[model samples]
Target: MQLHDSMIKEIEKSKDKIIENRRLIHQYPEVGWTEIKTAALVARELESLGFKVSKGDVVISSKARMGVPNQYILDQHYAETLALGYSEAELQPFKDGFTGVVGEMKFGEGPTIALRFDMDAIGLEESLSTGRGPVDKGFVSQIKGQMHGCGHDGHTAIGLGVAESIAKVRHQLNKGSIKLIFQPAEEGVRGAKSMVEAGVLQGVDYVLACHIMANEPFGKLICGANGFMATAKMDVRFKGKAAHAGATPNEGNHAILAACSAVLNLHAIPRHSAGETRINVGTIVAGTDRNVIPDEARLKIETRGANTAINAYVKDYAYQVIKHAGLMHQVETEIEVVGEAVGGKSDEQLIDIIGSVAKRLNVFDEIVASDDHAGGSEDFTYMMSAVQAQGGKAAFFMVGASPDGTGGIGHHTSNFDFKEDALVESIKLFTGIVLSLL
Candidate 1:
């Protein structure tokens, strides 16, 4: 189905306004759960567009006593709370807090459709040089040490623009509901699960999401793509006896050595013949003193695959390695599962709808299918799982944002940037999806 010519023209007319919102959001970047300023701005804009909004708070509570023995108790309590399903409101009293907001546009009511956009930015310094186009135009991020290097600013702006445009035509929309979700903490891949548990997708018939691609050139958009990788995040800790390196070199169990062994072994996880798999030890900390055999060591590791079975196998093998390394080193070991994201496959039916809209809008020279999956993961898997669990279908698409006229630097990099024109194109795509699905 095609959008009315008037609606297309209206979207075109608001292109400048949408770009302005994108620039404003880019100027003041907020990271993860600490998105107060960003959330406030988004809520204000969403309210102005005549959408009812809901705000959610982080759920961390309980205080740590300042002392020796009590410190361990406090730390354990904190970790346990995180492990359990704590409400977002329960975490608000903590030093660093998280917040979530949802906007809704209710129309004639058929199948409920939802569109999600992440609102958090990464911690990266933006380039001050004029070499990045539009910098001289004052469209650069103003915040220091924090910038929308991940294109989330554009995503949020596009979501808001689509919400506004859709609200204007609510009377014409057939029987269905549309929800705009501006989720937080997507950087750490921690937001969507909690939101899903909170019933964010409850009563929703279909769900859609998109990430702006800094690789696709201007006027080009991708519809069907299996892009995000399945991911498993694990925290491994090894406990042993601490002793002086010189005086009691042989007295300690060498937890640090055990940690090192596990890290290396994890990286050596064999490749899967079925699909692409990767393992990495992102962070490791052990030994407090140069001359001491540390009693405890911690390693943050992640594994990814193109599909679910490989992801599961990689994770199991990694756990076995960690377990055996601790046993061999004679140190107590504990593995905590931090996060997991399953791979995503674009729905062929949804892809067809997107292609049809693109053809009708003449937005792309060719609507090619994409099979490249990024090693990065998204918590949207939680929502996708919930939808499929309830006999519903979902898919996420990539909108081109490459500003170099070709794919630019990878996402989350300090120099990551995208073509500004892609923002309006994304808005159009989202609008079309809502119309067709509803």
Candidate 2:
């Protein structure tokens, strides 16, 4: 399972193309289910590399997809991709939010190894201010209100590089198959479930995924992550009768009042003694005029915990508060579960393999079994849990993307940027992992 020199050379040769694709994806950032262009590029590249590519229903189960944008937004992004010079045929498979691709290359048979890379960007405007590398390099997001605030751009590029490297060394591989999964809508912990439900992990013997973290130094690498919180993202709406505030205040069921009550009480939900828990109402919208009682209100909320039971406890509490708040205010309430992730841990076996591979590569300056996870939620947990349920091993790790040791800028913000060289290191590690396993 030693990585051959040819594989390393192929990865080395792809450095320029890898960076080029990263910048290309970063500049035309798409969010969530609107990743037509990004998926198209990945599909084309994998197809060119002689891998069988699957898309649309084969790659994602439509009914399992969450937090999808409305048809109008989907069509708008479809048209935007077309305007970006991608042909309708090139973007066809990614239409209607069935975004992402799975590229498979089999060499006889052994164990099926899958590598996942997320492809969507956050809904944040790019910073035009100084010190943003994308701004200075003229690759800042061209799309308004959409930017690759995380290192998904780098991850996507690393996936492609690994694909090329693996393709080059296919002759040396005797058995097993490799699957490169380019996922979308990871920001809200969406996308993975649909693909998993579509049977992506059905035959996956080992599933490996990674994230580029700005908080870790450039040469640092974690073999696998820990403390992935179980989480649920929900949207709530309140409907009430509108009336003149002064003249008919009693007739109006205050939707905003119910929303405010729910917000305040949601935050006040007693923290579980079992583990860390979190609740947030990230956005709220209601009302039209000053004198008119607000008729409707909508809230985007999320709850997280160290495990599924704890998260369910928080969700249940939040739900009761929301329901009672609406009833107390005389407004009808509607709650929708949009996204969810269950807690998972990386397999110790895979972690050991990854740690060994990292040490043999002689690239990473720091290697650890696990790093500071801070109980974040990742949709990859869905796939990891799924694969493990089928008696397979799965691991999701983190690669340091900060070169200057400042850990780069905070993610999900306008100023987010990271050292691009992390792309090569990630590709090397991932490609090496594949060679070691397959």
Count of clashing pairs, candidate 2: 0
On lDDT, the leading prediction is 2
Against the hidden reference, what TM-scores do the models get? 0.87, 0.97
Can you write out model 2's per-residue Cα lDDT over 251-350, one digit (the tens) per residue? 8889999999999999999999999999999999999999999999999999999988999999999999999999999999999989999998999999
Q: List lDDT for all candidates, in order.
A: 0.75, 0.90
lDDT for position 112 in model 2:
94
lDDT by residue for model 1 (1-438), tens = 347778888988998888888888888787665565566667777888888877654321112110112345334434444454554344333223335678887777478888888888888888877667538667777767888988899888888889878988887866778888888767767567767777778887788888888866666667765757788877789998988899988888999989988988888889999988989898898888899988999998888887777889999999999999999889999987666777777677877888888787777665765556555678777677777678777877777777887775678777777877887777777887778777
**336, model 2: CA deviation in Å?**
1.4
Tell me how candidate 2 scores on lDDT: 0.90
Candidate 1 wrongly placed segments (more than 4 Å)? 57-96, 370-375
RMSD of 2: 1.3
Q: Candidate 1, after superposition: displacement of residue 130 in Å? A: 1.9
Deviating ranges (above 4 Å) for candidate 2: none
Poorest 10 consecutive residues of model 2 by lDDT? Answer: 402-411
